[model samples]
Target: MEDLFYFKLFLAFTVGSTMVTLATVAAERLGSRIGGLIGGIPSAVAISLFFIGYTETPQLASEATSTIPLTMGLNGLFLVIYVGLARWGAWIAMAGALFFWVALAFLVILLNFNNFLFSLLFFILSLAGSYLILEKGYHLPSTEKILMPYTPLQILSRAFFSGSIISGAVYLSRVGGPIWGGIMAPFPTIYISTLIIMAKSKGVEFSRRITKPLLVSGMVNVVVYSTAVRYFYVLFGLALGTVLALGISAASTYGIYWFLKKRMS
Candidate 1:
């Protein structure tokens, strides 16, 4: 049993890293809007939820899954903060945002509603509110095209950072209860890492432009995916559940992306 656990952990790290690396590369090659859409895919979240379901009881996994959308909604706030303050420079904006994330995470955990229905309600409200707050006065920058080159080392580093975060979240899910696990699941690992790289290479404005679409797409993707995973993981098994959930998430993200592009354009 212990050996199986370790193997699944290893697999999560490997696959999660690959997916994030690919997403990062896609973001660079495609440009900010497309990159944000790809980054919003919830690759790491899917892997974490799958392994959680695989290693723990279905009930626990379902409980954990319920919190994901709420946490992701919080992540949208994090992006809003970071992008809103990007003029302060990447390090300061990120530092301030991280502080807010931690404080808000603790507050949510303390609230501890733990009811799936309430979580879904909170997720919807928070996502909509955050999107409105972010988009209220902000104007999308004119389309700018630039490609930032990454060396092999940088690519590897990005993958490593993302995989490490996913692995840590999995470990936390075991140590912490479902609520804590759910809170940690959407920690913005990929967003922070990718944003830092983009800020350094492409400039802060370029990176900031990516966050609006990322926030919109990510919230839609995770809410749909996590809700599906919560139900399907129990109704079906982990494998089929994950597949069906991911398919739903992909469709939702694509639709949201299309809507956002049209709205912004």
Candidate 2:
């Protein structure tokens, strides 16, 4: 049982890491908008929910799904903080953002909000509020130039780091229970990693540009995917439920990307 659990976690980690790395590379090759859209696809969320439902109970998985929107609300808070203070320095900005992430996450779990409808409402309001706070006077950079090409070592490192974060979050779900599990599900592994790299290489403005769309699109993906998983997990069982949830999430993401791209253009 123990070995099997570890194996599942390893599998999730691999999937999460690969997806994130691919998104990051795509963001580098394409533009920030495209990158943000891909980054918003909820790779970690999907992997965690499916494995949790598969290895644990569907109830626990549903409970975790219930909290994801709230957790994503908290993630919006993370981005707002990080972008607001990014001029100071990446480390300082990251520190301030993480402080809020931890605090907001704790507050949500303390409130013990379990209703899917209520959580979805909160998620929508929080996302809108956060976007308003961050989007004021925000403008995308005009040029699509790579500051630096990622070497093989850098790509591998990103994959390893993302994989480790996903693995850790899964392990934490067991220790912290479903609510805590859900709270940790949207840990900004990809966002923080990509932001740090961008900040260091491309500068704060570049990082901020990418972060705006990433947060907006990510919130949309989480809301839709979590809602689907919450309702369908028990009805269809883990495998089918996961497939349906991912399908909904993917379709939603594409629609959002189109809307966002059109609006921006």
Candidate 3:
């Protein structure tokens, strides 16, 4: 029954996320971030409800329900402004972007890249992520500069993040005794570093942005997932929770940009 629930949830997630991506593709001129929000809302609500249902503690449950919504809400606002000036035929731009990135992803996957792949990429992109918030006087020179220059970096970033997570997964498999230990392995380090970066970065109102509170929400689940493995011996659940938290944290950051966008406007 539990397995069935996860399977169904994944099916829904895939469908919903895909539809949202398509909406971004089809009507990019309509404002992609906004459209993406509209597209993503269904999945957000569904996943929100699922977490709300099983969350044992009242406080944690409240956090769970708001997690994805906060992300979408934040991302929506970011899109509204950043994409507001989008012109017609933006789909052509999007298609070009998609083609380039897919080819990039294929190359990363096939090459079996290493530390230069993940660690260096993280250091660099973490800086780029940092740039979006920091360096107020330094605006991106132009659209072409922002988009064109980022092509290789984008591929490198994806390869790195994916490899790091996979390495985490493989580490878990090797531990073999309890799932919680593996789940906990990455979080304390990752979360603390993220917090430092997010904390120090300027222009972001995440300090006041409480809706999704993803870093906190995600860290909570790491604990939950770890405990489930440590005490209850729910190894599989621990593994599932860690992976899910990874998705939530990374995706939700995009969500947060918008929430901040809305409030600022």
- Best-matching candidate per lDDT: 1
TM-scores of all predicted structures: 0.87, 0.87, 0.29
- The TM-score that candidate 2 achieves is 0.87
Model 2, range 99-129, lDDT digits (tens) per residue? 8888777887788766666777778888888
Task: Give candidate 1's error at residue 243 in angstroms.
Answer: 1.3
Output the lDDT of residue 89, model 3.
Answer: 31
**Model 1 over residues 1-265: C-alpha lDDT tens digits?**
8898788778878888998889878977887677756756888778778777777766677788767776776787888889778889999999989999899889888887477777777778877776676667566453333355777788899789878777777777787878876887778886787688889888888888877666767677877888888898889988888889988887887788777767667
The whole-model lDDT of each prediction reads: 0.78, 0.77, 0.31
Cα lDDT tens digits, model 3, 1-265, are 6575555444434443444334324323345455433323222222322232232222332222212222222222222222222232333323343344335333433453222223233434433343343223223222110001123343344334433433342332223311211221232222222222333342123211221233223323333332222222122343354345445544553465365455334
Candidate 2, lDDT over the whole model: 0.77
- Candidate 1 ranges with C-alpha deviation above 4 Å: 26-40, 140-149
CA displacement after TM-score superposition, residue 9 of candidate 2 (Å): 2.4
